[model samples]
Target: MTSVVPVLNDSMVAGYLERFITEELHSSGFTEASIAVSGGLDSAVVLKLACDALGTAHVHPVFLPYKASSEESRRDAGAIVSACGLAWTELDITAMADAYVALEPGIDRLRTGNLLARLRMAVIFDQSKKEHSLVIGTSNKSELLVGYSTWYGDMACAMMPIGDLYKTQVRSLAAFMGVPQQIIEKPPSADLWTGQTDEAEIGVTYDTLDQVLFLLVDQRLSPEEVAQQGFEAGVVRAVERKIVSSQFKRVLPPIAKTSQRTVATDFLYPRDWCT
Candidate 1:
């Protein structure tokens, strides 16, 4: 059967995203970008795009690794940095994360993972401040839709160049942009813990998940209709549930409207709004 997700014109997509990064940064009165490169496919692609958009010197890539993060992650992250013609910037979050982890005894993997992600977020923002650059996010549409990302952690960013692309599409784009093959072919992982992979946590491969997401979200098909298209009913419903449950991650938090105008409500303004 034909794939539900349309194959992207990688050259066009790359050119468009490069333009997007340049325009978004300039609009905000910034000329540089910082990204947290986790030795994963998404970050690798985003890093490449940023370097291409803003020049190697203008884009800073930092690898933030926890104690349990795999060595492969570190190596792959370094490879991408070299490929983009940038110097290596590494910050180990183990000490900081463990200091907090010690306070809460018996913290499960889930909570510890979140702590690590948020710590990385904090460090990356600080690094961006030091570099006077915006933090470019690496989240793709698949993670954003299914709520697979850490809230306020990996999701925190000034701009997301590849936010609209699905995970499968990201791989394709990565390949087209000459991202390291090992990074592109490896199983997707948050690297929160040793031997953990994204597909294992999401309970489905990206190939399956992206198709379901395209049918439900892009095609505007109901769950029932998606299942009719040869997708498993359970998988379709699970994907739908994730999209619904993770809606909060996709938007700004709501504020009570006691007055006529409130932040993110009636007082909405563009990021580049000037008085």
Candidate 2:
């Protein structure tokens, strides 16, 4: 059988996502959007879509960097700001992150990285409130499926225009939007620490992961079935484990069903209650 993942029409996806974002924000009574950009392809694509959705003036691009973040990342972020003529905000989060580190001098790299991610989200939300804007999300489906995202950190957002797109599709859309080649060609990273690349940490390139995920997730294949398609058993198992374990991060905090109409239980309703 041919690959289940359909070849994307970049232009159509871009138009669809941009319209989705603009319409959702307007319906929510928010005329502005604030997004944190890491100078990575995902954020760059989001930045472009937001700017196209609601003009540059109404889109706020925030770059929150810690001390270990690469200089190249900063330059690339600046390049985007310049190219889009956006009023970018540079907030150095090094001091703040260090304070937490100091409190626990021997904390591991993973802990420190999570702190940095959450700190950045805090900054994004703060900026959104200051500008009366909604926090836009840049996470892609591959990250979401593989449990690669930091919960309540990078995952906390008022809206996620790119959440449904995989990392591969993100690149396709980014190229369609004329995102800088430097960004598109660079290795993907969260810039949480020195020499940290996402694929390295994940132990699989996005192209490989996305393919298996397309079979496992979108196609809803059994792990055995996916492995039968020539995927390594170890990889299929690992990917399935991630999707199962990360279920909490993908949903609302579960409330105890003590009452008959508990929120998130029987009382489920659209957040835009009136609309």
The stretch of ten residues in a row with the least summed lDDT in candidate 2 is 1-10
Candidate 1 lDDT over 156-241, as tens digits, reads 99998999999999999999999999999999999888889999999999999999999999999999999998999999999999
> Could you tell me the C-alpha RMSD of candidate 1 in Å?
0.9
Candidate 2 error regions (>4 Å): 1-4
The top-ranked prediction according to lDDT is 1
TM-score against truth, every candidate: 0.98, 0.96
- What local lDDT does model 1 show for residue 212? 96
Tens-place lDDT digits, model 2, residues 219-273: 8899999999988889889888888999999988988778768887788688566
- lDDT (Cα atoms) of all candidates against the true structure: 0.93, 0.89
